[model samples]
Target: MAQGNERKSKLLGSGDIVVSFEFFPPKTEKMEETLWSSISRLAPLRPEFVSVTYGAGGSTRERTHATVTRLLRETDLKPAAHLTCVDASKEEVDAVARAYWDAGVRHIVALRGDPAQGAGTKYEPHPGGYTNAADLVAGLKKIANFEISVAGYPETHPESPSVEADIENLKAKVDAGADRIITQFGFDNAHFLRYLERARAAGIWVPISPGIVPIHNFKQVSGFAKRAGATVPSWLARRFEGLEDDPATTHLVAAAAATEQVMDLVDEGIKKFHFYTLNRADLVYAICHLLGLRSARTDASANAA
Candidate 1:
């Protein structure tokens, strides 16, 4: 719709908005350095909290734990650890949740992780384990008063047989005590708006935060989006066309596209956003800058470090 620059100044001039970011655990030492660099850069922005993703079947369990623990001790930002019920038994998952509590983490992004084989593969819950995200939410609640956020698929989850089924699944999660739902990253504003309408119609009132992925690496992001069942607008694909070799142009278009997307959502009365920050801080940092978010050092209590 409207470009970020074309939006009214007042719309772009709000006080620091409530924002959250998602990060994946680093797989290597070098990547670890980059991850922390991103954390340090974005930390000054003062997100509501930053979440570290859990890998499929708890593949990254140890790495995720290490990353989150470091965030607790190294930075001033609050950390939300992602816990998934994939291959683990109910007791195992509960123990992990207890470990998080012991580590001082109170917020959890509870998920029914991807199939161990991978996305698009069949998911079979471990015997005596959570059958799905709703089950996981209920179990986590028993461990502690976790501020749980669950996943929502704007476009039906790829594995879901129908959109109605997907919505029903999300409704169940909310009923199980989910505090909020963060959608998979989507490019089409209408898709998200419609999803919100449907969620409200279903009587699910939790904050369904739209996930924004500033598409810096277009091809890679497009592939991931497809797997996650997020639609890529044709207009968006064209924006990134012919820029495969030009990283600079890709970054520019990505920032503009994401800023415009969030502005449109804001115009539609959405006040909060969750970003999948692929661990490089600049693009997400720039998008937040355009959204009127300033460094916490100058204004808020985020300078706890």
Candidate 2:
């Protein structure tokens, strides 16, 4: 039960902690290079699994499938394909789930995606689509014994009618066979703690991994957080206020902010972490280093090399 400050010396001293990374499908050639580079850098750490996001309304469907399939074929990392209920009907979504199963991907990040207009917009479920994450999780279970992970909102989803309703929705997802809950990114550790408490009260005993978003582009991230209904503490804003033009300084600051956030969560009894890597590896790698994870071995690092 050592606090983060107390455990600082233990950070990166071992490689036993569990971690997972999130990456979105690349849309361009150059971005693809950057992503593989990041993948190369982080793969040695041997993350529990890496997930590729499905864009709103399945906008990135093809790309997502390609990326995950590539991981299955080329990389040793386990890949989780994100599936969402938004633009597609139940049968269509089922087809995608089956495709992933056929592709040898057993993990799925089941989600009820933001409105096609994006988060903060009014959500209108497609007429014949799975209406929410709960239904989607149930559907995936029917398709396969997929290891399903569903989104949890520590600060509550912007479109949720109330926090109680949000928790109820989360409970439904769990009851429908969600194995893990990865939260929306939040800066305040207290919010995460409270959310976990509430989830426990609601009868969810699954692992609730805190989602950590390193502040690579603070302004852009802050805007996204707001739209996603995640609160950005004023202190976090001040941490990146004047470093807009300084990428080097920004990375250093980003590392510190992320490290501090995770350390605090560790102090609050959270053991697992899910990082939204944003297609960059160094900062997340550093944070994991600070969390006591390391490259698996000479052979693995050589392969990722």
Candidate 3:
């Protein structure tokens, strides 16, 4: 391994780190207001793109579409609308894809979403829908030249039989025309690096960006990690052990923890990241600034790409 000092010197190498954010479709008017407020603050960062997530079983189809199209119409940010095969037929999914294409939205984060029954349940694709993410990718390609992003699981998807199988699944998606793979949120940098090494060995070279979730609330986030099949190391838990009632301390710790995580990955020569914003902007915005990104409009001519 390279020496820590040696790695630190390259933290901002060439000064370009492609970053993206993920947001869920808001479920209520107040939540919608908060989502737009967060967007207004983060839009200044000029991420490579911001994505709107579809709910499980295509539940947020209309909200996701409206939010995505609104971003396209009202802001300068590129919006990637998520498409999934969960409860829709192939034709219905294709129709949605066509509508996005017509709206001038070109990026899609295609997923084989979770079963509507929720986590730990088996995912059964709609009998007439695309069979999986790979199938969805292939179908989207036929509809239009959309930039497709598919999911990768650093820890191996819970339902997958093995790590090798997960990589093979990801490779299948890439081979089906996915432009990139954005991992499910992960906390351990080693897991991501190992996944990257194996993926490269298998000839899957499309940019595989690690999904980074800033731990604004360790309790809530750890719960998410557990459900998503990610490990929350004891050390991480210890850091937040006694901070549950301390919001100020938690905020500081959260920012520092996420910044350190990104810096570690940057030292490993990783240049791309996708943040699970959870519709909160302050922590994420801070992390981006720490990553050497300034507001693009603030310094467009010299901003990090």
After TM-score superposition, what is the CA distance of residue 285 in candidate 3 from its true location, in Å?
0.7
Clashing pairs in 2: 12-292
Show where candidate 1 strays beyond 4 Å: 1-10, 14-16, 300-305
Candidate 2 per-residue lDDT over residues 1-305, each given as its tens digit = 47544764354345546889999999999999999999889998888899999999899999999999999999999999999999899999999999999999999999999767865477788899998899999989988899999999999988779999999999999999999999999898889999999999999999999999998999899988988788888988898888999999999999998988887676656778999999999999999888887676755666888
- lDDT of predicted model 3: 0.91
Off by over 4 Å in 2: 1-12, 298-305
The number of the candidate with the highest TM-score is: 3
Error of 2 at 103 (Å): 0.7
lDDT of 3 by residue, 127-241 (tens): 8999999999999999999999999999999889998899999999999999999998888899999999999999999999999998989989999998999999888889998
Please give the lDDT score at residue 39 for candidate 3: 95
lDDT of 1 by residue, 177-235 (tens): 99999999899888888899999999999999999998989999999988888878788
Give each model a TM-score.
0.94, 0.94, 0.95
Number of colliding residue pairs in each model: 0, 1, 0
